[model samples]
Target: MAQMIAPVASLLFSVVLLLLGHGLQMTIVPLASLSLQFEGFMIGLAASAYFVGFVAGAIITPHVVVRAGHIRGFAVMVSSMSAAALLHPLVAEAEAWILFRFITGFCISGLYLIIESWLNEFADNSNRGLIMSVYIVVNYAAFTCGQLMATLTGPESFHLFAIASIIISVAVMPVAMTKAAQPAPIAIVKLDLRKVFKTSQAAIISALVIGMVVGSHISFAPIYAVQKGYDAMTQAPVFAAMLGLGGVISQWPLGRFSDRVDRRLVLMVISILGIFASISITLLDQADFLVFLIVGALIGAATQPAYSLAAAHGYDHASENGYVRMAAGLLVAFGLGSSIGPVVTSVLMQYVDIDALFLFPAVLLAVLVVYLAIRVMHKDAPVAENKDSFDFASTSATLGGVVSPELLNEEDRYVVVPDSWEPSEPEEDDTEEAASVEATDDADPTSADEAVAEDPLETKAKASA
Candidate 1:
């Protein structure tokens, strides 16, 4: 195990520090903004801006990495992220914070790209699952710790922001000094929206709904804790940490359960649970800290796994080689929903009541429950033999499409062979196989849209004929 992980250990170390700082920032931002007298709508707008930058960075950062190279790009992003963290306390205005949040979002997206793609490159089929599991565990643990760290100081003070900045700045040291080989430049995955929708309406729609629900939950949950009389010093952080903790613990069990039954059915169950949890929280007005903490975990467990289930459901219907494209489309839909969720939730909180925070997600979860029911009625479950195994996916802002090992099939894989590698003696068939490969390489590459599945109805008609 140690031998297998040695090659990418430095990258994982960097991830630990990076996520720690990021987790702190996510917890602090909304609380700080509220303390600065920013309206709920402005807080939501700021949250929306960050996600907008996140989606934009996912699209544009590849080009930057391609031009600047991974190590250099990683450094630049780390520095920018650190600066953004410090600027939040410096400026103290809602408008300035919005721009700072956007910058942080953009840098974070790029940083995830560099780190995740490097991990992807380092992995092979033999140990890929183990490596990914390790990454996921580390990712969640670090982020959760960071959230808890918010309790170290008051959000109104600049100390917490400084601590976050210091952590982010320190994140650069391991990667910069490491002697590990740089991974290949990241590829831009083109999204096929129409094909994705046709592949599985359940997946695409669930992605959007889950995105909105989770996005609002993450951005505003701290504020909700404050309104419920939880002090930012201890209670609020514990509430946020419980959410992360629940997500980490519940993913595997829920994911494995979905592997046996219809994933759509599992999604409906999750949506129902989310609604129940949200309503429970709303009803428990000014509950004790322990009760609020338990409710936060329940809601997290209910909603956090929806994205993974939806993606797994899509894979059940997607073509063998189209996994990457399918994931890209779902990611875009999720990003759009995340960007819009906070704004809508904020408006409700501003004009309606503080409880709208939970009410908003409850309503979205209800819509998803209705949608999933309709889908279950309209479409038969994919045969067990045809189902794709569930792989854990996070609802947090990340480059999930790149990190998922299942998304890249052998035929469509992007690997970078090392310069030290050598070919073995060739067999008689090698000459012909080499010639075939040469010819295939010389042919024009297929456009991204052309690689996705055709219309489902047209495919069914052709199959019937």
Candidate 2:
């Protein structure tokens, strides 16, 4: 285990570099758009253009991996990033950068494919969970730091662009120089909505909402900070930290707490907490540093687990194959939501105060919470008829379909809830395979505390966080 992990730890930089490079690069695009006299709609089109690339790359990443192999594939992907970032400052107009952004997004999707596929192939079944958990943690941490890099120079400075390039260049060193055996090619996850929707509509809705909310923040949070009076440096860390710290503080408890209760209920509480956080930010009389911290912490906590909650809720009623298919479909919905979220949120920020940044998410959460509440409460209101448990063993589609979050079996199908969760004895496969697999990669806390489902937005004073 130690030897395998040591090698993994070295290769882990691929994820770090991938994250930092993308994080730093993305922070500047929207900021640049605003400075360039681009309209809100154009800026959004620029922002969402990346998703088109992201989705396309994901669809074909498998072929690239299979044909080229991991090391070669990874190198090819990172080189594109270098090209995209260095050429960024060279582009004279917003329109050109939009094309660059699309290329960057497309390349980055392959990058994730290479890394995730590597993890899937190399991680001993027993060790994959731990390796993956660490991989996610590193990606999250580096991303936050990359965002912090935004603060290194003002949005308009060429320094941010240069730094973004340098990060990508350095990303090549770890894997390119390594002697590790090349892993197998990547697999394209074909997300069929008809199949997934047949399993559960709630899943689709949950995936969309989560994507929109998260995508909105990444695309515009820096701009929001600039509006709130912080410079780029402060903005970078705060934005990245908000999301990173949100996962840091919440993943464990939410994972654990979710196991003990109805996950939908947990999501509702988180949503309300999220609303309260942003609402307080909106109403604050002054924009203090502490204000950002407090608001970020709260909002992050509420929003971070959103997908998971939606996933758990939707999975409660999903079939085994449905869980796998739905997971991938969720990624698609997430991509769609994320792609659209920025455009909608950016317009609100451009037309309204920066404080209006929260309005998009707040409104979404508010409606979702109310609808979910009513659905659960009403005797025959739609959307609450299933009772499946969350299954972490299957590969799940999250964050736009490059790879599923949980690396469960891509081939086998099984029910979501534990057989014990049902009134009957455990299924044979569930009984033997589950125990063996759980014993293998048991450290992923997401496994320990997931439950089957079931939100509100409390109003607050308006001030920017």
Query: Which regions of candidate 2 deviate over 4 angstroms?
Result: 235-237, 378-465
Candidate 2 Cα lDDT to native:
0.64
Model 1: lowest-lDDT 10 consecutive positions: 456-465
- lDDT string, candidate 2, 117-199, tens digits: 56655665577667767766676677767776777776677778888888887887898888876543333344578877666
Q: Model 1 Cα displacement at 113 (Å)?
A: 1.2
lDDT of 1 by residue, 321-386 (tens): 666667677767787888899999999999999899889889998999998899889899999999
Q: Whole-model Cα lDDT per candidate?
A: 0.76, 0.64
